[model samples]
Target: MILICKPGSPVDSAKKEIRLVEIEPSSEFDAEICSRFCFVSLDHDPLPRYTALSYAWETALTTEQIKVNGAALAVTPNLGRALRYLRKSDTTVAYWIDAVSINQDDGEEKLQQIRLMANIYRCAQTVCIWLGEPSESSPLGMSLIGGRAIEGEPHELLCGQALTTEYAVECAQALKEILSRPWWSRLWAAQEFALGSASVFMCGRQWFDSTQLIKDGTLNMIVSILSIRGVPAESLMLLKYVGSISLTQTTAIKRLWDLMPSQKPSGRAEIFCEILDQCTTKLCSDDRDRVFGLLGLSPESLALSIDATYDNSMTEVFESLTINLLRHLDSLLVLFTAGVGHPGDVEYRSGVRVRLEDPYLPSWVRDLRRPRLEWMFPPWYGKYRTPFNAFASKEWTYRYANNQLMLKGLRIGNIPAVGLGTVCQSHFYRPGEQADGRRVLQSWMALCDVAGRERGRDPYPHGGFKADAFCRTLYGDFKTTIIMSGRGDFNSVRLQASDVDAIVQSADWAEKLAQYSDEEGEQEAFSIPPFIIGRRLFVTDTGYFGNGGAWIEPNDQIFIIMGCHYSVILRPTNSLQSCTTYRLVEICYVHGIMDGELFDGVPFTGKSEDESTEAYLERTEQLGDHVIEPVCLC
Candidate 1:
């Protein structure tokens, strides 16, 4: 038998492509065969391991009384340097090669078989593609990747563990040969760009040892493999990724849709489509809980495929679903954290917030989102992505309180960020700052200032009083400052003593505490020291003070004062594994003594509690405000 690609499509004749020829299948293929194929590795130490697995496979096959349906065909290039061994049935195993093209015999049948080449590769006992030589990054990473049970296997010899570096190079060079031939060119009849595009694309990037790198590369490669035309569906059968992360069901379905030619799809494509369709069906099951198991998310009623059949018009459907998928993923992340442990792992922390001006967009279309985003934020911070750290904290009792940074980006790629973007940006408040001057609330106010100063926007909730502070002071009253954070273009809200105390006292604390930081000694603008719960509240021009991003009545705030905050360190469990200490600033509302009333009190009161201006950590643990409830973003 000879394999050939259909040549009606355009191609350069001189290039060589992978080809194979086979002798007829034998009824007596049951004859005990010798090694038909073998592993090759440069690692001298690994020789023993490959020798072992080869034997293990042979024994395993023999134990099952496996019989080849036909003469064992070795489909490979002429490179024997990589061939370790191939002896099946005492040399009865037939072979084919590109180095020695098949003789012109029964050409049509061969061409047909070649079209289904992907399927052939998939069904193989194993393709054993070269993984390239291992380098400095591999040994430890490989050890972790390979389970404890398989550690002893001579993977060095069988899997080219030491040759990973060179493997990709060799593959590119070899693939160049396979794709360049007159026969292989026949397969390029219609989808010509795919071959060169895929070849160059694959050669450009290689996987690193980290689990994240391995995972990212695998996903990209799998998508690449499916997108290319004429690639065998079987190419995925042995498609093993180093990491244990499995493809989400939607991903698997998408890959199948992209790679397999459904119209006249061969056995492999047909079967794969069936499997994926079943997966889709399972995702859309009537049983609500059952759907998540199949889709890694809840699936919509139907999926529109992205393929040759799709039109530019179909982009709407794709965009819509993709956004929904992202939203679903974000929701799931929250769901996973909920009820986990007294919000121990649930603190939102500070992270970037990426909101797209136009959620519905196509890549080819120019950025049409500039108008809306610009109006919301200044030029430097508008039209595109802006990152902001949503400051959140865990209870001191919980171990995760140090603070976490989350990075978010949008409209940047076809694959939407899972939380939109994959980057994380986290900064933390120091422990010493938790004093009674409403330190936490001060931190919150500071953020508002920063947001307004840097981005020309306030960190206040939209339509809230704090937003009004944007017009009053670039950096709002110092209880908190929203400053430029590591999260892209977003600001981070850091709490100060006054803000912390007020947050605890007021439920809609975002509003009621507007004038609470007032102090008779307060001046218009002054930076608060990091560790001061300073309580010399100054009387501010509340008569002229602007309200949260909105106009304030001159009578709304008569006096503005500062209050001291209490600090506490708490956690969920005693385990040392996770104990994030939090310094909470408690804010108190204070009233000044009437001018003459101070000395003319009805009866000389004994020294009142909290009268002294010293750090007053209470002797008793305050249970009411000790732990805070996790703020939900949904």
Candidate 2:
């Protein structure tokens, strides 16, 4: 007979009371896992010490039963295994596990507890990262992470000395299994780990200190070892496996580890937008949690007066957050993440037919429910530099009303032609795919050539060969490089003459590789950054070449909004003659005018050389062709 778990008593919000579970001790591994809840006030003289559990909720369907306060409680298999492994035989231990500590059915209590999540983890004596049940190789993986060899044998893998090819491949395979676990992809895991004062990794019967891995440089050392020359064929395969996981998965964890409250630079609060962007690839069952789950890490959450509640709809929550970000941040940077457009909208090679407005949100709001593209211009922080000052030091001036975003900016001309859109990375790298990445790239080159000839400008009007401009525009004029520690870093650097020549040569090399080779390794030699996965190439009516969103089409106007780092594509919603409103297509990268060049010179019309600068400026605002005025975005 299955016994249902009874609801616990309500938490006292006034006193900041929270629930903690005391896992009953058991001598046998198969003994029934029993736990009881106890309420404690965070206001106590000394905070109650417990180990907080950080894990991924792999699924909500409970598959196992555990005894909680003399009643049976349904829990996920992973959580049950975690509890069984953590329960001590000698004495009862207290744990603050999210699944048990808070009543899941009670939204009010969840919200209240969530607001205190940061403190809950911070006050804990330790945070145990449950990476799930162990495999045959799990013990070896744990040992290697702790700077030991297989079966406790001595090895130099982590000591910066060389290891045998056989051991290197074995160790790489073991590490791959551990890093490929689902917990690393979780959004909450990052938050829990960052907020915790101390953290430990536990996998079934084996565990290790997280700091030891960092101090010993195990991950870096392994990467370097695997990259060594003259390795065996099997080791090379393992090298690729380890390298892919390290770049895509483990780097995120390491980055968050660096930003933990204990390790981050002094006096620097985490930027909310940057955090949101970083967590875009993270997994969460509830889309709303994308914002709520990250609030604890961002002080801007409190500054914007955001409340943690499930009462609001997903659209409402996302829209509210976007508006708050724009208003409080005093910049239009929030819009950079918006305008992905609804999935149902059709994108064709010749043109696009967008839905104009999302059913649940204005075009200006970023719907966190959908996948997002990489920012065309990253924020001016850390290793990234924003090369474009499109508005030339002007501050953002705008307001929102009736779900419309009004902004002041000068309209650069519309797109007269658009090239083929880019395809998914799988199609580019994977053999036997329908779309050829080379064909797509060559088609873009063909379009540029045709457009330039049609306009009677063989060389680009920007005074450079069309090929050079196309190559530079494809990369957004930035050089991306991997640092010594395996972290990817990109900076906005002006492409030097040599860099441009090398890019052209690489393009030619890629064309030859595509024709002769089907091997993924050979194809990867000529690759573009993942950022350009869904972007398209386009040429403006006013002689500018750019990279834009896949949904861009002819007649879509580009705008250099004040205080924005990059140019934006805005599709007019009304008649072209008197269009006052537009649907935001997406942000784009225009080649020539990124450095405030559009506003470069003014020939004062019918004015004497003696005219004062102030009078000339006043006259230009009234009579100039490029006037900055309010454009409404719906």
Candidate 3:
């Protein structure tokens, strides 16, 4: 049996009126045989205790016509399944399922309900998150979560060694299937799960404690376990685990956000950018919800200013979001996540060539309507992992109106050399692909050689002109060895050193590099594999080495905006008037001068003792005074 309520009273009324549906459970197994009745409210009544159903509302669900209060009502098969599972056999169970409890046809009522969603979820006794039907992996995954302990205490499951028995493989497979569910990608589900006081995730008849799944150190445990099993660090499966764990990690992240002390309002963009980072991969039926669904979790002032108005188009809503974010936040950090234009256009290597889905969008604005496989640097990876001040200089002034951005910044120099335009000639980053790895490695070496000659010095800062130095220059630090529990025999073993010697001496380096597997022999000072995916290496005309987008081309100028921590690449556009305009390219990381401290100390100098030094000195002297100009990015 099930009870459904439809609100009939004004949202602000002191007295509330709701229409209830009293459903009678049937002995028949068929959904068509169930009997239900709609009970219209004749008087205001106190709301009854009910459970909330937070689900994906899958767009592809087959509509099943069922009798709701003796009338034919069409409901998605997924929703129908949930209703049938949650209904009680004898007593009527009250539920606040979004599809049925709210009047979908009424715009006013919908807006009112949406505004009250946070309170509703918080007040509910429990939130049952349905993840469709269970697979072979569900029960196994639940068991592993509850009972698996191969080496250390149960709590340290993934951190320590795992017996390489058949059981270990089963656990891996179970984890993979459990995380592949569609429920993880829904944008609305993020806040719904976060707001619920007591939440249990349901997949068919099996339910797992959400708290246990996201227990502290879960991600580190998973990474440790996978590494022990010799899973390649760059493997797609490992990346999937990272993505899945990120979904669970949001619980703690959101809690911290909720606990932050409220002070004078700075701007919602800071909070909004963090939320966007967490929910970037989440799916939404309407593109606008990509930004709107996060409003409640933002500051009260932000939420109040941006009403729950479904009347606006997606582009309009996005434009409004951009304008408000810029007005309140003094930084352009939000644009950091822009991908290669449209999803399909991602194959292009140059940032300037990255096609925009909307021609009207300002060059600085990125569209978040679709999800892409290429992962951007995590926000925490940036300085303090918080939004750094984008206003780089006191002289920096920006004006935004008419959907245009006008700002002042210094143009440092033009790029004389650029690294491989694309990673393995593909949009997606899969270093595991054998052929792709060869191409990427070759392309990387070629660029290093070119930039090395252009700068009149070795590309590597250490180990002058050696292959190891080139390896460091190319992969950052893949040469260092690590210690971990052995998978085959020894209780403790070391991962091998991946330095230039190991990579070049062996024929399997291509495949080996992909796995990044190692055994401890000798450890050299090598930093962790640089998180340099989607990065392009470049040398300026003055021979200052830096990194920009792979899409960067020869002659593209690097600009240091007043407040930006990283330099932005810009391309000069054809201007009919005397005023010059530049298109916003991707932000860049220069090797030793990201902090701008290196700018004032000394002019760029070449390390070579050859005649190239004279040429480098002459080129350095050719550098002129910094030029400041007003520019428009649209």
Candidate 4:
């Protein structure tokens, strides 16, 4: 039906006004849901009190009707249920629900409302999260989250209390069911939860305080149950099973919790990038919402220029975002998210390849709409540890022309030989079925051997043993481990030669390989490095061993661009012009030049302590026979 605008106080676009729904009191919960719209100016003093709703717009085709201002309005069954449950018996309630407050059919109004979303949620007296009607296990889930004391021994409890095996299993299963619900996976829910001043989670008649979940250690308790030591083998296995199913949701919740006003970063750019990285796995119906949904959580300085209109094409939206990132951030770390290639370029399993529904977007732009199989660098390297600086301290100079990204860099060498790329079968296969990974590693080793023999040298061009370089390149020169200090905690340290030798020469290599996959819960002491899951090994003409994207071929050229953390592979396009036009293959990890070795006139180690900055630059320009010029990528 139609939502009537106020007689004289229609939405004042200039005053940052919004509409809120007033749900009339009803004694019967099942009675016809009646609501009316009222306008409120956020800029006005003594702001109106209302609760904002955060929920998943269910994808079911079926819908239910509700009366708004005496006119029928269509709504999803999920929303209808939420409205019915939220209705009070005697007192009327106010809500700033997106489905009813904003007219979805009006693009301009939608854009305006989106721009005010942050304030809307931030100003709300409370934010109520609807997790759908309760199931049989919901009471147990709500009880655990509500911090109800569990009956357990001191030793069996997560920190000190002793938990019976049966009780732990019950709690794990209950938490799994709750976390697996659709609400946790929606991208918009994160912004709503993070921006709300106060939030309460409701499931049918059960409710829990979000603050209590943290202050009482209920969330941490659930996490510890999944990973705590000394638990029975059967109970541990069941917990691992639960973790395997709900790891993504748990991670999302933890990330959102960290973004709450208390812990969120102060810088605009930091908040924007953090949200983008953390919410990569979240889902939204419209691809544009990949950026729009998170805008409300970002600082105004970073999001002010990013328009939230639906008229722009997906390619345009992503291109604008990439340009904005380049203009704001100092490093080219954003390029790492560009991903491997378009769909069908790299197969993730035996018969499955990564899918990109919109393949027409520019190559340099990250397609956040699809699931990325692998990133150029591991999370531990970029997040917990200092990233590589392949180009030293050179400042980047770039410009966009004809839809191509042009930047200045030095071409290092061309890939002369390539090994079989690893296919990511971790999600498709279970433990003890990782033969494909072992076979691919064996193939890479053989390729390295052939290259060494052809060069007829015991030492690589970087003055290190060929075997050492190969080993280092396999794991991206770093080792990652899940530290037990907290949930999902990762720590990375540079790999030592002895550690590599011990792993390669171990008698249980095959068993360890079988146990290794990219899955989160299955990581072990000797697990395979997750960084190389969907990458290939390549040897350059200069005898540099590298781990590159799965799309690398024999003739792809390597370049170290200014401000980029790692070397990048570029493939020449079929342009006959004198100036070369190329496509960005992927960011790569080369053993010798990762620490500015190429830029400092050194082969293996970085610039000597005695050399001055000017001396280093002068020597680098002449020693390596390198030339700095503009490189174009379309």
State the weakest 10-residue window (summed lDDT) of model 4.
482-491
Tell me the spans in candidate 4 whose CA falls farther than 4 Å from its real position.
1-9, 149-173, 214-271, 342-358, 375-379, 382-385, 418-446, 449-457, 475-528, 601-623
- Model 2 clash pairs are none
Residue-wise lDDT of candidate 4 within 1-634, one digit each (tens)?
2234542234667988888888877668774798888888888788878889998898889988998877777889999989998885367777899988888777778888898888899899999988889998888776665554355321234454556655666666676677677887788887788778788888896887676543223454555665553345565455445443334443444455455445333233444554576676777888899888877765554467786788898888888787767765444655666634433333356675544334576668877765444454544544313457888876555677677787766788898755334543332333454555566665666666623333323577777676667766765543544222112455434455565455455554434333433334454333356666566777777767777765666778888877676788888775586457777777888888778876664343333578653333333233366666567777
lDDT of 1 by residue, 246-276 (tens): 2233233334434433333122323332332
Q: lDDT by residue for model 3 over 1-634, one digit each (tens)?
A: 2233223323331222233344455444565724343322212234355567888787985788866555667778887876675553567655566676566777877776666666667666678888777677777665444333333334355444545535555666666666666666778878788777787777776776665554435544654576567665555356456445445545644664564335334334445565666676677898878767776565555555665678987767776766566555655664554423224343356543454345655556667664432423222243224322333233244566566666655566788645324343332233344355455654555555532333213444322343444444344333233222223222222233444445555554344444432224322211113344555556566545554555666777777665565667777776674446666766765443344543454343322456442232223221136544555566
Evaluated with TM-score, which candidate comes out highest? Answer: 4
Best by lDDT: 4
Write down the lDDT of every candidate, Cα atoms only. 0.24, 0.64, 0.54, 0.65
Clashing pairs in 4: 153-161, 153-162, 154-160, 154-161, 154-162, 156-162, 156-163, 157-161, 157-162, 157-163
Which residues of candidate 1, in runs, are more than 4 Å off?
A: 1-81, 84-121, 133-144, 148-634
- TM-score of every model versus the real structure: 0.23, 0.74, 0.68, 0.77
Question: How far off is model 2, as Cα RMSD?
Answer: 8.0
lDDT of 4 at 148: 46
Candidate RMSDs in Å, in order, are: 24.5, 8.0, 10.3, 7.2
Worst 10 residues of 3 by lDDT: 521-530
Model 3: what TM-score?
0.68
Over all chains combined, what TM-score does candidate 4 have?
Answer: 0.77
Output the TM-score of candidate 2. Answer: 0.74
lDDT of model number 2? 0.64
